[model samples]
Target: MSWSLKIFNKFPINLSSSIHARAFNSKAIGILGVPFDKGAGTRGTDKGPNALREAGLIDEIKHISSNIDVKDYGDVHYELMNTNGRKIHNLNDLSDVAACNKALADQVEKIIKDNRMPITLGGCHSIAIGSISGVLRTTTPDNLCILWVDAHLDLNTNTTSPTGNMHGMPASLLVKELRSNWPTIPELEWCKADLSLRNFCWIGLRSIDYYERIMMEQYGIKYFDMRDIDRMGIDKVTNAALKAINPNGDRQLHVSFDIDSLDPLFANSTGTPAGAGLTLRECLFLMEEVHRSGTLSSMDLVEVNPLVGDVRDVTNTLNSAKAIVCAAIGSNRSGNSS
Candidate 1:
């Protein structure tokens, strides 16, 4: 009945490092890399996980809380298959994406069952489909709330998607309210529509499509864009978001952060870059608040395409991603320990 026993056979855990033994550990953090990019129209994001690891994500996080046990689950690889008979438009590599997400879901579920926090490194925003579903396997849907930090709404269904990129439709597939609108895709049948509109909130959004905007308004999903962040500040936005989604403070928090959520000035190595977005300070503050709340159970930091940018741009993007991850896990950049 243990989580490990149930799902480990499906997705084996491959620990890439043992640094936790040397650190002062307080909690266990499970790192799972989904090295998939077929979900997006771009190709470089598949390298994001290794790029982040090479940038010293584990070391930096360990420096913050050496007592925290960090276990790297290596990377999940998917074999590409011909989609000659598929019917979904703009959605490429449907089979491979589904397979990768299914494995990711199993790995994430097992990590939660092992009593560890899951930190997923994305191949694309579509990875949220598996990561969030994995978390749902371990807990009830109502007890979970998702904090989606991105520039795009990512609420497009198969029929409404302008770009058949699976990354743009994760929010739609994950929410039960939009299930009826989704086109029948057999590859994605394994995905359970466990998230509810009430359990979701958006922060740092800027480039929303017209249909997505309509859907958000129709569903009354709470969202704060760059303008709202400027109007109310990141702290106020974070407070309002947490209050709206996890009102009682007892629900589990799953943060799905797209690197594009940060302004292109801060993180420009992503596939989709927006002009004005969350500032580095705002991002860190938001993650710090989430860490302090003790409700953060899982998170996905996705869409850092190192191959697209020059060395300096890559460095800025990677460092920004690292800082955001560390902040979520309780890192204090001010050198003042709480």
Candidate 2:
């Protein structure tokens, strides 16, 4: 089926102004920055949103398409809670994370309702809980497919997580099927969604936890790890992932990319850097393929820590992130913008 037909059939309310129309008639991009990092174990990732902005992400994106309209919805901020003497189980900073994501969910839903493609800059991978939730509010969960690109599977629930970092458990919390198996966490009650395991596909996995591995196997989640990429090549892996996630070519695509998905040699600033990951070229190719497929609706770039490395290291990683975003938006090094 053609891309226009696929998009029109899914969102008929704006038949004349749907995503297909925007691709040709108008192009607008919404940018929302999530600056909360309580979900993470580290402190510096909170500054990631602005760091990417300072790296000229907006300007680069503008260069992608001449007619593209970009709107910046400023960062979502929260007051830090003092949990010095309190005992938190399974999840850390539960209340703060919930509050921040609630606000994020509202903003993202608004952006999508406005008929704009949302590009969320993240403080941590956990922000995905809100971003995905927000997208679900605006669109049917069964009609969306998530392309999760990360070095580690962020599928640990409170029961499976060795460390109580909420950033590592967004996938587990977002999947509706796992709710029955999840421990009762009242703070996350509002974060629930009907996200099917079949709608998710993982790439760049190299450091999955033991329990996460078990869950992936038991559920038969579609995944293409670094080893698979090495054996089958990036193009084949990308094709296989898109086919599995969007079998009918009508699902909206949401890409939640963790910067750590890149090899440590390219992205060392993230809290968890895994080796034997996708190279910068491979990552760009994957994003470009997704863009060309025309199913992309939203994207999240997370886990970039400017404070973790020297100036050069940070610069390299930041530039890499910008290039990846540009590629996802259909920019080409050969001077073609879409």
Candidate 3:
């Protein structure tokens, strides 16, 4: 929180090498990485975890506070299950998605049991299936609420997805109400649809599939799109979303943040870039406010594909990602006293 830290936020380089750790709200953060990207069409999104680390994410997060305890549990590893070359219709890499997410769920459950807030880095947005599943293992579905921040609904099922990407279908897979919508997948038997759409709220949505929009209306899902943010302002919209999902502020909160929620102008390194998305400042405020609520128990920062752009684009996107993670964990605008 020193001047150097604030400056580092604006200019990542040019900081004094000897800068010291600052005081911050106490947190025991458990970090996990998912290096599998078969859920999406992009090949490089699997490198998202390492890309953030190489950019000094751990060091910067450590620098945020002397009181914060940071532990990296390393990357999640899973082999693609044998499918005998018989692929499900409109569902790509179903076995691999099942394999990776099941392992991810087990590891995440362990982290939560150890009394640490699990922070997962993503290979793609599909990783949410495991991350949220892990949390549900320890916490009751009714006791937890989710804030899904993304430019897209990600609500398509195998029946509705145009691209056949598993990443676009995680939302549907995780919701209990939509269980009937999915056919029996022997591979994904490990994942149960326990969480309801009623406990979930979405923000920053811009591009939504036709069926997804209809489904939202049909289910009466709570959400705020870009136009809502534009009309109501981010602060009001965020507060409304929070109140709608976690009214009385008694429920534990989980945030699933997709990098594509950010505008392409700022985070073009992501696989799916939506124009006119949330600005960097708005994104920071949303995360920081969630932290301030003292109810945030877990989060997923996903969809950062390093191979999608040039070096500068990757750098900016990673910086934005680090900022989002830090803010969610209680980083603030005020600098540590020098």
* Candidate 2 wrongly placed segments (more than 4 Å): 1-26, 78-88
Which window of ten consecutive residues has the lowest lDDT sum in model 1? 17-26
TM-scores across all candidates? 0.90, 0.89, 0.91
Model 2 worst lDDT run, 10 consecutive residues: 17-26
Q: Which stretches of candidate 3 lie over 4 Å from their true place?
A: 1-26, 82-86, 336-338
Pairwise TM-score winner, candidates 1 and 3: 3
TM-score sort, best first: 3, 1, 2
Task: Provide backbone clash counts, one per model.
Answer: 7, 0, 2
CA error at residue 304 for candidate 3, angstroms: 0.5
Residue 64 of model 1, lDDT score: 80
Give lDDT per model, in order: 0.83, 0.82, 0.85
lDDT of 3 at 76: 98
| Tens-digit lDDT track of model 3 for 1-338 | 22212211322221122112222223888999999799998788899999999998888888778878899999999877776776678988888888899999999999988888899999899999999999899979898899999999899999899999999999899988999998888788888898899888889988999999888778877788887788768877666677677766677888999999999878999888989999999999898778776778899999999999998999999999999999888788786321
- Model 2 pairs in collision: none
Task: In model 2, state the lDDT of residue 294.
Answer: 80
Please give the TM-score that candidate 2 achieves against the real structure.
0.89
